[model samples]
Target: MSEDEHETEDLQVEVAGLLLDHVHAPLLEDQHVRGVLPAPSEAPAVRVALGDRGECAPSRLTAYEIPLGAGEELRTSHDVVALLRAVHTGTHIYLSSRVTSVMGMDLYLVDPAHVKEAPFTTDDWASTLLRCLAHPSEERPGARLRGFLFREGGLLRLYMDSDEVPGVIAADVRPGGALTALLAALPSLLGEEWRTSDAVDDPHCRSLVDLTDW
Candidate 1:
């Protein structure tokens, strides 16, 4: 693995540790988790909660720098925690590495999430994550979902695909209510080319691609 990959794994490990440390344990389970999930409906309107405490810990800097050990970079626990929280929440993506390396990592993570039973591969990851990020916001719910990107040679890849999935089946919200609004918004976000030719099957359900950039 490259130095960057090593750092990302370190970040994930660190974040997993935090989930074990900070976030209330009860919340991890589906029961007390409340409606972190979406409601059930055909189509419903939703708005991006700008005021939501959208944050990235170690926000100022992702990876640490060392010099001679002087200008080198190091990863921190806070960075990992932030990424884990975002992923667990179904937020889009997050990172724990320096900005320069993030784009590449994103590409690496996408395949594992989208390819399903198919084996994850570098090319699969590249296409999935790149398409997701390259796609526009209307195609997705609040673009506020965030994550880190890592560099792979010259390309930017998504390292993590967070919980951007709308809680369509959870509670209160109908299945596709919020997702429909987002889908409606996609044509503009990704330009007319992204307009889905097929009719929405369930106005309430948010397709995996609908929530993320892909």
Candidate 2:
């Protein structure tokens, strides 16, 4: 082949590889979204602080912390997995987002036993969450697990709608918290970076899932 043709072919291959990498990158590896992951055994206990409210731009937000025992830290991904396992043992787990419209929000529900059966890894849990967040109608009924994860100002928010006592529980991502660990582990979990944007017109925002559901 001609030198110029060979060079063109090489360029095409390089471009293809780059595209593949981008397509496979994790959805939450962005520095702004990344969270810390701590060792589960040494992690601090996280208490569920109720009635904690804050403001994020145009709306007032309320956070309902999830209670944790010693060596149970929401700041670590491992603890998060444990929490999910514990909660799912006998009840339904629903993930939901903040109500942005008068029509209300859709709740994503997942099978607890299915999640529990997954390998005890951060990536496994993250994958479970991503699967839950996928387009509900497009997904099977068993995958319609409900929950919400999004960014509000400087805080990363997670909301759980379950059949438990708290009913609707919320967790704000702290430094090195489970939220961060989940986001950090997402890329590895999905084999690609998942991209999201704050712009309302963005595809993520306009679609069934958006930055609000991150």
Point to the candidate with the largest lDDT: 2
Candidate 2: C-alpha RMSD to true structure equals 23.5
TM-score of each: 0.19, 0.19
lDDT tens readout by residue for model 2, 1-214: 6554444344333323322222234322321111112213432222111111221221221112222232321123344334433433454445565212211212122332334432344344444444434433332332223454444454433443323212333433322325444544432232221332233432222222123333
**Model 1, C-alpha of 26: deviation from truth (Å):** 5.8
Question: What's the TM for model 1?
Answer: 0.19
lDDT of 1: 0.29
- lDDT measured at residue 31 in model 2 versus the true structure, 0 to 100: 10
Cα lDDT, model 2, residue 7: 43
lDDT of 1 by residue, 73-173 (tens): 54343332222233334433424331233312211122122221222234333333334444544444343223333343433322222234323211111
Q: Model 1 off-target regions past 4 Å?
A: 1-22, 25-71, 76-190, 205-214
